[model samples]
Each structure stands twice: as C-alpha cells, then as structure tokens.
Target: MDANQQVPSEAALLGLLQQFTLETERYVEAISNRHHLHRTDLNALAAMVAAAREGKTMTPGALRAALNLSSPATTALVDRLDRAGHLERRRSEKDRRQVHLEMTDSARATGSELFSPLAGAIAPVIDALSPEELHIVMTFMQGVIEATMTARKDAALAEPMRPLPGT
Candidate 1:
C-alpha cells in the first residue's frame, strides 16, 4: 500500500465483521418485536422455514443442536411456537420418538413479509457481484463462521460453563 493507503489491520477488519453481524441481529430483534416473538424464537422459526424451502426436514434434535439448546428447552420452544401457530411438530414415520419441526402457514407468510424487504434490498448488492466474487464472499463467510464458533468454544473452555439460553 502507498503511504496514503494503509492496509487494514486484522482488529479493524474483525470489528467490521462483528458489527455486521451485530447490526443484522438488531434488525432481527426489531422484526421479532413486531411479531411479538422472542429473538431466539424468531431465529428458530426462520431456520425451520428456510430448511423447508430447501426441501429439508428439520428434526427437533437437529434444531436443538442448531440452536444449542437443551432437550427440555427445545421441547418447550417447540411447544411455544406450536401454541403461537408459528410451527407444528410431527412424529417421524420410521421412528415415532423422532420429532420433526416445521413452520406453519402463518409463520411462512409472516416471516416472508417481515424478512422479504431486507432480502429485496440486498439482492441488487449481491447481484452486482460476479460468480467468482460470490464464491469468494461465501468462502470468507464460512471461514468467519468457523472462527467465531472456535472462539465460542475456547471461551467456554475458559469458563465454568453455563447452559445455552432457553435451555
């Protein structure tokens, strides 16, 4: 870099990455508030809907792992969403004990209405990128996600440890 154009420091880049996630979370919070849902509940519903859109089945156990919640808490979460008419639970055909979660029609509509605007806004920004640029962005995001997970694990190792929220 020229004297007038300094390379970005790792700390500065990390801050930027963190701020992006943080701000996105604040946006999620706002959407959740509008829907009278907890942020975690909103996230759970969103994940279920997204998975369903991709023709994937989301088991309650898988959701527990995904959300890092305890079994009882996951059950409670499933119950809450079910009661709210945002989600439904179904027993596995092969294994009755295996519970699967899916978003209800109301959830599908509300989640889409709440989240589609942000998707629409970002579409152009993503569309501006070439295929190679998109790949690079995906690779970078995967690396960042892995690094964040590792950091969380390391932090947990350093602590006495508590259960995940809603657990």
Candidate 2:
C-alpha cells in the first residue's frame, strides 16, 4: 500500500488473511491449553462476553447455534463450564423455560489475563490507523465474516467427499 510498493493481487491478499487466521488459532489454542480449557469452551465464552458487551443476552440455544454444536453437546459443554465456575446459567425471569448463559467473574479475569498481552500489542497498530482507514478495515472484516458464514453453510449442505479407491 506504500507508494513504492505494488498493490497485492487478490490471491496474495487472501493468503495474508489465511495466515492471520492460522496465527490467531495458534494463539487461542495456546491460551486454552494454559488455562486448562478446551478451545470450544473459550469460543463459547468469547461469544457470551461479546454479547454481554453489546447488552444482549446469550441463551443456551443461541450459544449452540453460534458454536454449531448439537443439543446434547451444548448441554454437556454448559455443564462442564458451570462445574468449572467459568459459566453461569440464569433462568429468565419473564420465561421460566428460557435459560441464559453468562460468563463468571473468574472466567472474565482469566480471559483478561490471557489476552491482555495480545491487546497491548495490537492497540498501537489500531491507534495509528486514521478514522477512514479504520472504517474501511471494519467493513472489509465484516464482509469477510459474512462470506465465511455463507461458505460454512454451503459446505454443511454439500455431500461429503470420499477418498478414491485403488490409490
């Protein structure tokens, strides 16, 4: 993007994105291991925490869908996290049948302690971005997220590939 640099091709840009995703996954896996938590557990916690920040409640059903988990699997996950004191299940006052998911104080503290270093490293890069650049990056990232969701859904509906015989 610099004056002396050529604009990257779409393939090059996609390669960069893929690299970024892999690196992020590595970081998440490392943190999850250190905290004695499964990667899926961390993902569920992250979803709930983001929902809380947006003033939206996360329900068990919603969490299941967000994580693409089966009902039984979700129930097991909830039970495990609850037992670990990292998650709370609150019955909705308006609907006794509805159960909302929330992160416990311990979970929040663990998340903060684990991710603060990454945030500190990235904050300066974000801070240096101009408003226009930030907006563009946000829009681009959102579009990529939506595209990934669509691709996932499509892949889910497709027939599974089988290995060729007589290799």
Candidate 3:
C-alpha cells in the first residue's frame, strides 16, 4: 500500500467490533431505562445478584477489587446502594470479620424483570451460533474488552491536571 493507501488489519477489525459492542450497550441501556432504572445502578445490582446466584458472596474488600475502587469509594457505593434498598450487608456466618453483600428481594425482582426481555431477545441469536464459533467470538471479545479496560486504567493514571474554570 502507498503512504495514503490504507490496509485493513486486525486492529481495524477490532475497532469496528468495539464500536458495535458499545452501541449494543447503549441500546440496552436505553431500553432498560424505560423501566425506571439507570444503567449504572442496574449494572451494580445485577452484579450483586449474579454473585449470589453463583454461590459467591462479595465483601467490601472483594467488591473494591472487583470494581477496582478504593476502600472509601467502595464503602460509599455500598452505602448508596444500601440506602436505595438495592442491597444489604450481612455478617458472614463463616467469617466474622467479613461482611457479605446480598441483593435485596426488591432489587433481585426488579433486575430480573428489567433484564428478562433483553435476555430473551439475545438468546435466539446466541443459540443460532455454532458452539465453536461462539467460543471463538467470545474469546476474541474478552481479549478486546480486557485490553480496552487496561488502556482506560493507564489513561486515567496519566491524565493531566486541569485548571479551574476561573483560575
């Protein structure tokens, strides 16, 4: 290719893939918001519900790690969610020092109802893909997502300080 000519490569393909993924997420959020939940709150509640469903419990420390948040940030998130009646912290039966995070009944029901249609719409598409194709696509998508996440972390760390509007 000449200097001005472009050659399509894996990077170009991944860019298109990422765009589609983000668009799908935006669409899902728009649809879910019709049911009265903001996308971020829904995501947090869903995460807590999934962990409970999978027989895993999250402590404040685990949540901090999972969200890549500091202890104070995680505590604030937990407090807000708790006050919203979406989740509760309980003393762990097996470990006294650890508090297990659990989704409240209302949150679980709301999440399930909000997501059921979205899940139904995607199920057929997923089912149509062959097992091998699904695995390959999932693996590639995971890799792309991980790379994007790491890049975001690095960018945040390297961000320049901004001056106040009038200062």
Best by TM-score: 2
Scored against the true structure, residue 14 in model 2 reaches a CA lDDT of 96
Clashes of each: 0, 0, 0
How do the residues 1-167 of candidate 3 rate in per-residue lDDT, one tens digit apiece? 78997799989997898798898798768866676555656656666766777888878787777667778877888887888788889998887888988888977787677768778988999999999999998998799789989998898799688998998
Candidate 1, residue 70: CA error in Å? 3.0
Candidate 3 structure, TM-score to reference? 0.67
RMSD of 2: 2.3
Better of 2 and 3 by lDDT: 2
Model 3 worst lDDT window (10 residues): 35-44
Per-residue CA lDDT of model 1 for 1-167, tens digit only, reads 67998689999888898898898998888888887898779879867866777898999887888788999998898889899998888888999988788778898898889889889989999999999999999999899889889989898689576788998
TM-score of model 2 (CA atoms): 0.88
Evaluate all candidate structures by whole-model CA lDDT and list the values in order: 0.86, 0.92, 0.79
**Candidate ranking (TM-score, best to worst):** 2, 1, 3
Off by over 4 Å in 2: 1-6, 164-167
Off by over 4 Å in 1: 1-6, 49-56, 161-167
